[model samples]
Target: MPKRIMEGKVVSNACDKTVTVLVERRVTDPLYKKVVRRSAKYAAHDPQNICQLGDQVEIQECPRVSKRKSWVVISGGTGKPSEKRIRAGQDAAVEAVDTGKIQPKKAKKADEETVAEKTDDKK
Candidate 1:
């Protein structure tokens, strides 16, 4: 049988040689027909300890590493920027918004403007 592989983001690397990966999947509700996102965290073995928090990684099923760990990290993932830098940028944006230093872009009311133009043409 083929082993399962999953792509997820590293949520924690606090444990030595082990990192927690968060895998998210979108599922549609049968009754409401709405899509909802659900996530699961799995502890994966990181031999080189290369994965950092928020870094996207690919994990594959492997022999059990410990009581709750049965996955191993695969190298050459998405290679996104470091999580710390990403969070710093995000925090700065949030701070700017909170301090009123910047304004969020408002969505354009294009449909409303088009209707108003049509009304003017008819009148």
Candidate 2:
């Protein structure tokens, strides 16, 4: 059988070589077909001790590292920057910055319009 890999943010890094990763799974009720989000926290082994709380890490199945740990951290476990994970983060930042089509930054203020300056200089 192949090992399973998961990517999520580290919610806890209080223990040595260990971190709690919160993995979210989406499921739908068979009867109602209602979409639901299921989340689980797994204790993963991070041997390098680089992961910090809130950091994003990729973990893979491995020989049991502890009573509760069934996975180990993978190298290049992308730290602070979650390159593409969407979770009330940078993507939201991009959206926050996008005020639809942007009004020119130098657009004259409403009270600053000048009629003589309105004619195109290029014309």
Candidate 3:
């Protein structure tokens, strides 16, 4: 079969040497008379690790690499556009002021003590 190519945005480049790209396509439903959007995630090989999250990318399907990485990044170009997911512990700061229901967890007292000791050691 001929090679298959799809255009999409780079969802993430956090993996050690791989980039996660998400390709979106629009298709019209014959029965419903509506257009639907669909997206598929692919892990692309990124040896340079230069592609940043949100960067648009083009991928070509090839023999399965490992398990989920069947696509290879052809080139790194400007993304015309899109949520992969945030890292496990790092999340964006909330935009609005806290309503008290939610507060940044106070650093535990033990952490504070450690900070104090570190400061003392530096002096």
Candidate 4:
């Protein structure tokens, strides 16, 4: 039998020589017949420790390297963050601002007075 190959995004690379890949697939619901996305996480071996978070990677089935790792990374080690990761970071920043965890820089006093005067003039 041929080894199974799958492409996914690396969600984590915190382990020494392993990265967690999140593989998503579309499946039709048996009862609703609606297509839904399903995802699974696989621990893949990365001997060189090159894979980074949000990196797209191809992993192939191989003999178990550890208790939960049976896939080996075959290709793809782009260090750039993916769009999803960037959006997540933006969301986190927004949340921090909303919760007062991060204070946004204040506008200059002159700028604030001008904006206030404009609003007053419109009234």
Instruction: Write the number of the candidate with greater TM-score, choosing between 1 and 4.
Output: 4
In angstroms, give how far residue 116 of model 1 lies from its true place.
Answer: 35
Q: Give the per-residue lDDT digits (tens) of candidate 4, residues 24-114.
A: 9999999999999999999999999999998988899999999999999998876865556578999999999999999878879999899
**Model 3 CA lDDT for position 37:** 96
Q: Count the backbone clashes (under 3 Å) in each candidate.
A: 0, 0, 1, 0
Native-referenced Cα lDDT, model 2: 0.79
lDDT digits (tens) for residues 5-120 of candidate 3 = 88778888778768988889999999998999988888987766767888867788888877778788877633423233233223433433244545666768999999999999
TM-score, predicted candidate 3 vs. hidden true structure: 0.58
Reference-based lDDT, each prediction: 0.87, 0.79, 0.74, 0.92
- The best candidate in terms of lDDT: 4
lDDT of 1 by residue, 7-120 (tens): 888989899989999999999999999999999999999998888777888899999989999999985333475466679999999999999999877867997899899999
Candidate 2 lDDT by residue in tens digits, 6-27? 8777888899888898988899
Q: Name the regions of candidate 2 deviating beyond 4 angstroms.
A: 75-79, 86-123
TM-score for candidate 4 = 0.67
Alpha-carbon deviation at 63 in model 1, angstroms: 1.1
* TM-score for each candidate, following the candidate numbering: 0.63, 0.67, 0.58, 0.67
The alpha-carbon root-mean-square deviation between model 1 and the true structure, to one decimal in Å, is 13.5
